[model samples]
Target: MRRSIVAAVVGVTALALTGCAGGGDGSGGGAVEKATIAIAADPGSLNPITNATQAGQEVSAYLYETLMSFAHGKDAEGLLAESWTESTTEVSFVLKEGIVCTDGSELTASDVKASFDYAADPETASPYSGVYFPAEGLTVEADDASRTVTFTSAQPQSFLLSNIGQMPVVCAAGIEDPASLDSTPVGTGIYTLEDSSPGQTYTLALRDDYTWGPGDVTSDTEGLPKTVELEVVDTEPTRANMLLSSEINVAEVGGTDRDRLESGDLFTIDVPARPGLMFFNQSEGRPTNDLLVREGIAGGIDRDEVASVSTGGRGELMTSLVSSFTAVCVGADATTSLIGFDADAAAASLDEAGWTVGADGVREKDGAKLELTFVYPSTEAQSVVAGIELIQQQLGEIGVEVTPAPSSSYTDVIFQGGDWDLIWAPISTTLPSTWAGILSGPFPPDGGNWTYNTNQEFFDLTAEAQQLAGEDSCDAWTAAQASAIGNLEVMPFAESTSTLYGAGVEFEVTTNGLLIPTSLRG
Candidate 1:
């Protein structure tokens, strides 16, 4: 078991979030016309194509509409596209008739084609391009008369339908004028962006004409809030307090606040996630580049303690990087092959690797001190700090000096290849294919492989997995994951339930943790 800091940070905006007093409370008093929710960060940009942050995704959940709905089951349901047929290298979608954009323009297949084409363009530089749309050799065609959109990829992608279907589609107008979409959203979602106050608040108004929701859902569904107010509340305790007071309808509360929130009459929607994971920098010259040092560090630390302390004993020890919501193959126990805690073995490993304890009690190798910079996200709960400190002491006992670096710009540090030996950032995704690219692809500046992993066995297994569809690829993916875990390329330590506490609100969250706007009822 291992635990590290968050790779992402809270958004740029900061605003005081206060709940309503009487009428808006969740106690079934007066009309439930409005729903106020607390968002941890202020989404800097409203453009769905460019921003992929948690705050952005939350906001976009109301403003943008995807081709298909992401559900807990293995298959994806239709949203924008009524029906879709997919093959290894090709996918075709038929637009549902009567689907209209916020501007009252009928959503045509041409709009879908334009959106994909724009996102696929290199000049657009959308981070989601390769993940949602194929990064290379993607061809799209549309027939407005037939309401059909066809896509063909150069390489065979097993999960093409689910991947491409989930990409938020911009309206034709937004596609033509990308600059106009910077702060304003133009899609066919169930809600429209009513107003935005940059770092303060955001307002979304429900659309009365939105009848073509996922499955048989319609705008007239009971409990759907007429209006949604998103307020930036950085503190988890503050958000929890607001929820308890009925000042806010919904808020995500973590750490010790969860126990208090659960004791109340409020409803909870739990989003399963891997919150504490450790990634070692394998780039040249980094101390962690040495396999023996990684093994030494892994052996010295008690992962069970890290998980318990970090999550206030609310987290379960994770066996894999894939979270429960999106894990298609759950029986694979690759984590069992990872190095376990053994202090004696840790010391032996360090000594055999030529690191000797110096007068200061710090190890020295090649006349250089065995010191490392440990980085983590600055916005994590207080419990996470305690967990990090525990790791520092455990490593210190093994003669390794660990300097804790809490950063607000954790993603930037990882992307720019800053000075870090180990980092804590949980990777959350809807597919196993995503894990492969994140762990073994081209290193940063070229791609998202932050650790600079060069595991040939992992790469080969992942390649084999990508060629097969559905459960047929599970064996290969699990093998690939085991290879990475056994090599200590990354360490998944703790998993937690991200509870969204709601007072008067009733809602269901997607597998990856975004609140399904259509499911919001108050």
Candidate 2:
């Protein structure tokens, strides 16, 4: 799943430039064949299995192909796999014929198995394996004759197909040398990396042999750009200015910049995203480990104020951790009573926990101050900054001292470091069961449960939900969410739309806010 929001920044208005318009052939007179788009940060590693940043995932979408792709409110569509079958605990897929890797080798079922095996191996240390392919009793086997790969799970995995289908399939070369993938990546994607400067820019050239794109996308698709350039512009205002001057064609924009872009000839696409979420460190040593403190923090934040500031009054206040767009877990208002704007109640809850207000107005227990290290992504998006500031103020009113830490790359700080009390990162996934894996997994060094929640009921409900499929499992999913909310395992405050603005180009943004490069037009 893609994570992180685009940074919004302020900048002076730049003069707009007119770019040549053309079709896919590049034959139209003076038509521009190359296009540029701005991504938030440099994808330090191009390896699909290890790359955790949102910007990296966006760029990987072009350099790699997943077995299946999820369409909003629709069934998963085949990409590398032309057809698939599933049982309660097993899923089988048939690879498309004649698909070749950029290295000129055939893409066989064994390669798929090898890729998964690499990710599943703990030695590889892939952050996505647990959520995508649970290690417990998971196995993969390939049938060369039929070009088929079959996956079996020890326990019932209702969403197995959806989970594994979205994983990016790499060749043996990438699996063997994961470290080298940071600079050199080889995959059977629609485009191949032509050139790149670590933190500056990345260039991709279209692959004419790419015939296995998701849905209606194919090599013969119309309006596809000949070459794509990803400009690493961290500032939203700089990106907006670049778009206006035609220095770039597409970018993710927010705040007043979005309105300015929409007011002009640029096209804007709004994709649903979980805006603001608070993740607590529930480990033994963290202050947030105390249930009352966690509940107090959840109850203290004003959702309306956060949502209003986060989206500039353009987003909705979320009542549940699960987004409304989630099909199976629709209408799950799990956090209804668990989280609300009640400063007095929050203060009282903290006091009941034996954390008394000190002379400094900050709560103290056993000579320890109630101080939390709240970290958020360092994005120029002022609304996100404002929302975090508001959360700090609200928590402060309840006697919790918050130290705001802005990170240029949150994944590094989250997965590698342990010195943090809370993190304001919202996870995005199409399947609700994904959340189950994240919540139940071991904490930090052992697994991906960054929050370190040890709630048995939450783990049980999520596991139960994973065992069943369709509407029959909605109750369990809802219960799992409720359990988390009730325990203050996570605080989901607002849901906002991710807006992408394009200047000289037109393309569709996926339901999850991913740009469909195959849909790009000049």
For all predicted structures, in order, the TM-scores are 0.88, 0.91
Model 1 C-alpha lDDT per residue in residues 1-522, reported as the tens digit of each score:
011112111111111222332234533333368999898888878888877777888898898888988754324689888888999789999999999899888899999988888877766656677677667778999999989999998877768887898888989889988988888789998889899897778999989898899867777877678899999988889998888888888888777787666556666655664468898998998888888988999999998998899888877777666766653665556687789999999999999888989999999988999998999877677888899899999999999999999986677788667779989886677567777657754577766577989888887887788788877877777788888877889887887766776676566566577788887766
Best by lDDT: 1
Cα miss at 489, model 2 (Å)?
1.2
Model 2 earns a TM-score of 0.91
Q: Where does the lowest 10-residue lDDT sum fall in candidate 2?
A: 8-17
Candidate 1 vs. true structure, TM-score = 0.88
**Stretches of model 2 off by over 4 angstroms after superposition:** 1-32, 73-75, 215-220
RMSD of 2: 5.9
Candidate 2: the clashing residue pairs are: 8-380, 8-381
Each prediction's whole-model lDDT (CA): 0.78, 0.76
